[model samples]
Target: LGFALTCQYLAARCAFGYGTDLRAAVFRHIQTLSQTELDKLGSSTLINRITNDVTASQSGVNMFIRLASRAPFLVVGAIVMALLIDWQLSLIFLIIAPIVGFLLYFVMHRTIPMYGANQKRLDRIARRTGENLDGVRVIRAFARQKQEDERFAEDCAELERSMLAAGRISAVLNPLTFLILNLGIVAVLWFGGGHVDTGRLSQGDLTAFANYMTQILLAMVQLANLIQILTKAQASSLRIAEVLETKSSMQDGTETPDTASEEAICFEHVTFGYPGAGDPALEDISFTLQKGQTLGLIGGTGSGKSTLAALITRSYDPTEGNVRVFGKDVRSYKGTALHRCIGTVPQKAVLFTGTIAENLRWADEHADEQTIREALETAQAAEFVDAMQYGLETHLVQGGRNLSGGQKQRLTIARALAGKPAMLILDDSMSALDYATDAALRKALAERQGMTTVVISQRATSLMHADLILVLEDGRCVGQGTHSELLETCEVYREIYEASAK
Candidate 1:
């Protein structure tokens, strides 16, 4: 009993320990994967790999630890005792063992590939479920809930079909074992009884032979359980290994930007597109901006304004040409160092589940409340934030679902402001605000004075005040000048200005 308890303790530790390590390994690999790699491996599939696949691997570890130290020992000991009783009867043990071994091998070999396909089907089901939950609002707004349900059901049915197919293959192992082992037992009895009558074997000896045969059967059963886990784990491990083996496309540079230049950003002949995307999102886009200069990007939808912003922040490398910062290539800065110098607010405002202070602190880990308050003021978010009873301590739900759109945008801007980044990119973030608030926010941002700023907006008023405005269309800059210069020289700018004037 004490020995059994010890085995259980070791098994638990081994399973949980290996599982914890595996989860960490997978997570770290995910962090190293490029944005393209991440898109290729969907969130649902990655989640499945880290959680369900790791858990399956844990089960394999548990079975190994529990049976490894005990089963072989018992089987060998039992067989040795049986041979002492009757060497002839022990030969029956050898003959049946090989047959059982062959069957177990066949089952394991056949089921491994099936298990791999099953895991992939599981990924599809998990992905569909995640999409359904995350996009529930959009689904309901479109009144496609029933269609989504059908889609989810289809993926789940596929998973179930794969599971059933693998289960059927696994099921054959036990029945085959029983049939062969039962035959071996009958042979042991037949021969042992004859020896007993011939006075070569005692009744006690014959009974011991039967017990040995039963012990061999039990060991084979345990081995079968272990093999089943191994086949499953083999599939999961291969999946995990695939992720680990994938090299990140974005390589980190060893050096920081040059120290002598105040010009914080420059893009030269930049053209870029997603892999397999037929057309370049931005083509031959060249621009330069110094410290304290505000460059406004004005373009219609699909005109590549946001894509240009992504390049400046080094979210991705330009397929052709250089994005430079401080007279050095943007690729020269390490990932964390590159982000440290840029504060960006996306079109959609995203906030985490935390108190207002905690969310702001993600920008500057040690920022004081005064810094936070100042940023909120600059964003024109302080009015509502201070009116709240908790103020900076106000709690937010996931995605800031508890806050209004304009409020979320303001908080997001404030969080970025608090970080005191060297450059700020507002990617159409002012769309949620009223004209009055938008003007106020822009004035406050301009008052910051020395920071380089790039504002991407469709609003003519937003770009009109910028020192330089670039009008984009069809992935190229058809116009690059001040708002007034563009209106005089560029027809596209004239149309946009005329439209917004009304």
Candidate 2:
């Protein structure tokens, strides 16, 4: 019993290690994937593959290690002993083995596909659950609780149906296996009893033969259970392999940007469309900004403002023409090299659970307290951070749920500023701030010398003072000039400004 316990412990430890290594490898690979690839494979599906699928495969490995050799060895050894005891009576072995093999094969063939479909249903349920959790506020704000609950219930119901369908097929294996073995045992009893009565077989040999038959039956049942586990593992491994084998669409570059260059950014006839999208998000866009210049991007919703910013960050390569930074093609800069030069505040303000100082340190791990405070001052976040009990040491919950919207936005901006990047892109990050705070942030940004800035905003007043303003409409560059120049030459700009004026 101690030996058995030791073997079980070793098997469990091996499986645990296997799962940890597999999850780590998958997570590392996911970091290499481009934004386009990530969008194509949704977060929920990837999460399911890395977690649930890995666990299933790990369980299979454990079971295989424990029973794979023992069950078959026992079955084969029992058959041989029965043959020696009475070769004629051992005919039952041949008939029963084939029938059991066929039954297992039939069940495996039917269940493998069902298991695959069941995993997909699981992905759907995961996706729904994630959507609900992430958008709980929106759901409640719109009074969509009932509708969302109903939708989630439908997903749960579908998953239940899928699991039940697979379970029903698998349930037949054990009972049918037992029935076949029981019938074979009855055959053995009848034939062995007749032989014993004629003195062809001893009563002792008949009893021993029956014992061997019982051993074979138990071994075969264990084998059947192993096959069920293997089938599920096979299905899950296929899913895991799909993720492992997927080559990232984006390749890393070796060279870094030249810091000495005067031109900060240039977009030359660049056009881009999302993967599997019907139309281009940006078309024939061309522009250039010199070092220290402030460029403003103004557009309505879906006008490709953020998409254009993504191009500068090399989040997705442009489909046509080139995007250059620091006098070289943006594609030539290595991933980390480019990221180091550009600090970006995305439309959504995301913060992890940590102290404010810890969050700011993400941009520059070696940044000192003075540097963090300076960034906060520039972002107009100093006032609030200083007022908090612990100041920069104040702890934020996941997504900064404890903070107001404007405060989160400011903190994100400060995190970006903490890096002292060569170029900064604020992608509508000021929407949460009041007008005075927005002006203060911009004024502070203006004080930073030789830092190229791109501000994407709907508020015309925000961009009116920028050195150059580009008006975008339906993915086209409709106007490019100073704010006053666009108001005169561009009807779209005039309409937008007039509306904002109201």
Candidate 3:
């Protein structure tokens, strides 16, 4: 009993280690993937693969370690012992074994595909759950709680049906194996009784033969359970392997960037399209911004303003032309080296559950308190942050849900500023703020010497004061020049400016 306990404990420990290593490896591989790959896989499905699938594989490893050797050994040893006692009666073993083997094989073959389909259904359920949680506020505002509930229920029902179908098939293995083994035992007794009556077999030998048959039945039951676990594990492992085998389309470069270059950014006739997209998101986009200058990007909805920013950050490579940063081709610089010089506040304000100071440190881990204060001031967020009871120590809920929209945007901007990047990209991040606050933030940004800024906005007034402005229409550069020059030379710019004036 002590030996058995020790073995079980060791098996659990091994399984835990295997799970930990597998999760870590998958997470590291995911980090290497480009944004295109991430979009293709979907975050919900990736979460399921790392968590639920890994757990299933771990359970299989634990069960295999405990019962893999012992179950088969017991069955084979019992069969050999019965043959030693009475070789003539043991002929029944051949017939029973073939039937039991066929049954297990048929069940396993039928259930493996079902198990794979069930896992995919599980991924769909996970996706639905994530969407509901993330969009809870929108659902409430639209008064669609009943609609969401019905959708979630539908997914759950499908998962239940699939699971039950697979379970029913797996359930048949044990009972059928036992029934065949029991029938084999009765045959042994009948045949052995005649042998005993003829003085060829003893009563004690017959009793031993019956006991061996019982042992084979019990062992087969254990073997059946192990097969069920292994089948599921096989399915889960294939999913895990799919992720591990996917190579990142983007390769990291070896060269570091030249931080002191005068040219901040340059796009040379660049054209880019998302994977599987029909048309290019950005077409023939060419522009250049010198160091410490403010460049504004004004575009209509779906005009590819954010897509241009992603190219500068090397999130996706251009399909046709080159994007250069700090006087070097973007593809030539190491990813970390390039990102270290650029700070970006995306359109969506994202925050984690932590103190305000912790979130700021995400940009620069060693940023001092004074630097944090300066960032908040530049973002026009210092007043509200200081008014909070804990000030910088105030803990934020997930995604900063406790704060209002404008407040979250300000904090995200401050977080980007804490790094003191050479180039800053604000992708419509100021849309939540009022006009007065937006003006104040722009004034603050202008005063920061030696920092290049790219402001993307739909509001024409936001870019009127910029040194250079580019008006985009349908992924094409329709106008390029200072605000006043564009108003004079470009009809598209004149129309946009006239409309915003009202």
Candidate 4:
């Protein structure tokens, strides 16, 4: 009944919504992670913490409650029974006590650290495996499957070696304990025989004395097992605590800014680095976009375009300087207020397995069907969606595999637009669309939307009509102005324009 009630409480408290909220908290904690910390281990190790480490901790807690609650009563009961039988024979148990205690102590001290190290290694293996799985299509296409297989095999082997070593060491503990215990029993027999021969101990007394010796050792063995379990649990608890206790470097500010501004977005002398990076990904960058203005950003890959977007979204904080939205530091307007105002379509369009309407609803769950359809129309996705058998209700496979690349991009755009955000960021979202489709989408946005927009693109055609164009080279802004001005004054912009034109 106690076990059932305990399970019921856990089940009720850890139901789907509760578990999801907890996992989200844990997930967010992992996101603002430092490269140094993540690099020190692997994804597999983190998974172990979320899975095996947690299990070990719960098992240890259960073991502790069971053994600690019962051991004292059993020990006291056995001691009293032994004294009633023959007090002298009970003295034989003292000879073997220290040996068992020392063995348990030895396992306790050494095994805890080993378990910790082993969990770390398991995380490494998980990280490697997760990376390979996510990139399996690329691996196969590039004929690198064999290489990945070798890498995965090596990780698996390392995990096996660590587990085997720990298991082998722990294996010796139980048997050695019993061996010393049986030796103590042998000594009792040898000593008890003399007592029996001298007529000092009765037959029932001798029989009961033997039973008492067995019970005491069994009780000690249980205690030893409990110690071993507790040690492992302690190690695991420390690891989980480390993650749960870590403060996100990008904590939201306590104060919120209610004052809106004409400047929709601003980056003021921003400098940022990944955790522990020697050089900043972005340095002393500054820019501003007025309400309803379209700002075009062009740069080479890794020139910090995505990092800029992440900073704008407040996914991370600048090491020095500030990113402001609505004329207030973004840190101040966090949680729902800031995010609801910005719509971002990442470089890769990710779609969950759901109906088209459901996916769009993520942008605004309260949005009606008319709002969903209008957003789709603005994205130039209404035509395709209407052609489908289920229209907005059509089920999508994982990652929107049922749709073509352009369709997925349009769907993502529609989803972003459904929120009717104050600011819109399209991070190379048009890459998968054809030139004609891209032009159509741009035209539709120009005619329909009044929000501030930032478009990151490699193609010159995508930004030819922007109010302002910022050209980046090697992480520095090389040119900033209208397209016509850039073409006339900026050599790099001219070169990029000519190359794309050709």
Using lDDT as the measure, the top candidate is: 2
Where does candidate 3 stray beyond 4 Å?
Answer: none
Per-model TM-score, in order, reads 0.95, 0.96, 0.96, 0.89
- In candidate 1, stretches whose alpha carbon ends up further than 4 angstroms from where it belongs are 258-260
| Residue pairs in candidate 2 whose N, alpha carbon or C atoms collide under 3 angstroms | none
360-404, model 1: which lDDT tens digit per residue? Answer: 888799998789989999999999998999988999999999999
Q: Give the clashing residue pairs of candidate 3, or none.
A: none
Per-residue alpha-carbon lDDT of candidate 2 for residues 1-502, written as tens digits (9 for 90 to 100): 8856776788888888998999899999889889988888899999999999999999998888777647778888988999899999999888988899999999889988889889998998899998889999999999999999999899889888888988998999999999999999999999999999999999999999999999998988888898899899999988888888888787888999876689999999999999888889999999999999999999999999999999999999999999999899988889999999899999999999999999998989999888998899999999989899999889999999999999999999999999999999999999999999999999999999999999999998899988889899889999999999998999999998999879
lDDT of each: 0.88, 0.92, 0.91, 0.80
Higher-TM-score candidate of 1 and 2? 2
lDDT of 1 at 287: 84
Candidate 4 structure, TM-score to reference:
0.89
The weakest ten consecutive residues by lDDT in model 2 span: 64-73
> How good is model 1 by TM-score?
0.95
Q: Give the 10-residue window scoring lowest on summed lDDT in candidate 4.
A: 11-20
